[model samples]
Target: MTRSELIAQIKQKKSFLCVGLDTDLTKIPEHLLDEEDPIFTFNKAIIEATSDLCVAYKPNIAFYECYGLKGWESLQRTATILPKDCFSIADAKRGDIGNTSKMYAKAFFDPQVSGFDFDSITIAPYMGKDSVTPFFEFKDKWAIVLALTSNEGSADFQNIENAEGVQLFEQVLEKVNSWGSIENTMYVVGATRGEAFLKIREHAPDHFLLVPGVGAQGGSLSDVCQYGMNKDCGLLVNSTRNIIYASKGTDFAEQARIEAQKLQKEMQIELEKAGIC
Candidate 1:
């Protein structure tokens, strides 16, 4: 989806919620195991239940990749079932040598190969521009580079001082923005690091931020928007465990919808406060 279309969705839904499909076969309802593909069966129901309450869906690739070929096939089927208007993301965190990165791009962006046709892919910037630019070449797709993550380990590298003492993530944001415009580029900012939102806004005031660390991670939605929002409501606040895994029973999907609705209702209030609706 384009920037305008995303913003329009945020406006239309009165939400900036992004639901994470971190589906784990081990945790789904026992009854679903009787289905041909339990993971896809669970995902389809969850998407049907909560698609209207969210503006995007992010399927973290690790959950599926860990299960091997069956896991991959499940991901393909899940992606096919997502609502068309909701922006889809493959939180693959992929970046490698230029040639390998090209293949990764083809894997995710080439609708023929993966059947994902995701609007965005999370990419690590440690390897620098050559590893990132290949993904940017795809038309209307996005390269969401990692910036300040929400994990405690983020302090280990992302906050390290440079020669001038500027944090590493700050430099990453500034340098990466030169590689692509705000229209096609975005940064991943963890919600747990809400304090850094103001600093990030100072660096890329108009760019969209794919925010994780909410819900189960304990990041406050209100705090993130207080400092991170632009006039366009440039934030996609994501929740994973707290929503999709809300219940491990046959009513799991209905339970997921309840969790999503709670977040969307909260988001609607935030949007109203920001005059975004």
Candidate 2:
């Protein structure tokens, strides 16, 4: 979706919640195993339950890639059914050589070639511009580069300071923002690093941020909004296991809805406070 469309959805839903489909076969409801495609079945139900409460859905590719062909089919089904107005992201975290990056872009953005269409793809910027630019070639698609991740290992590289006294992630923000605009580029700013949001905003005042690690990871919603929110409500806070795996029983979907509703309500209040709604 385009930038205006995404902002419109955030206003219409009074939310910026991004539901993560980090579906694990072993962790899903036992009863769903009887279905032809348990993962898709679970995802369909989850989408049906939380569609109105969220503005986006992100499916981590590894979850299905490990399952192979059957898993791919399930992802295909999930992608096909995703609500058009709700942004869809392939949380693949892919970036390679220039030519290869183009293929990756086609895989996620071109449904005819890859059997699924994603509004955006997560990218690792370790290889620099050529590795990341291919994804931006597509209209209305986005390249969400990794900035400050939620993982502990990120401290090893992302926090390393340069000779200029700027940290690696800060440099990344400046460089990546130069390649794309606020319209098609976004950064992955982990909610767990709430304190970093202020610094992040200084560099990316207008760009949208796709934040993870809120639910199940102990990140505070209030803390994230306080620092990360922009005039357009430029944040897509994602919750994975805490919502999708809310229960491993027949009541799973209902439980997921409850979790999503809780977040949406909190988001609505934040939007109101920021005068964004």
TM-score of each: 0.98, 0.99
lDDT of 2: 0.95
- Root-mean-square deviation per candidate: 1.0, 0.7
Worst 10 residues of 1 by lDDT: 111-120
lDDT of 1 by residue, 49-141 (tens): 999999999999999999899999999998888788999899999999999999999888999875669898999999998899998899899
Root mean square deviation (Cα) for candidate 2: 0.7
User: Which candidate number has the best lDDT?
Assistant: 2
| Prediction-by-prediction clash tally | 0, 0
The segments of candidate 1 whose C-alpha lies over 4 angstroms from its true place after superposition are none
- Candidate 2 error regions (>4 Å): none
What's the lDDT of the predicted structure labeled candidate 1? 0.91
Q: Write the per-residue lDDT of candidate 2 for residues 193-238, one digit (tens) a residue.
A: 6889999999999999999999788789999999999999989999
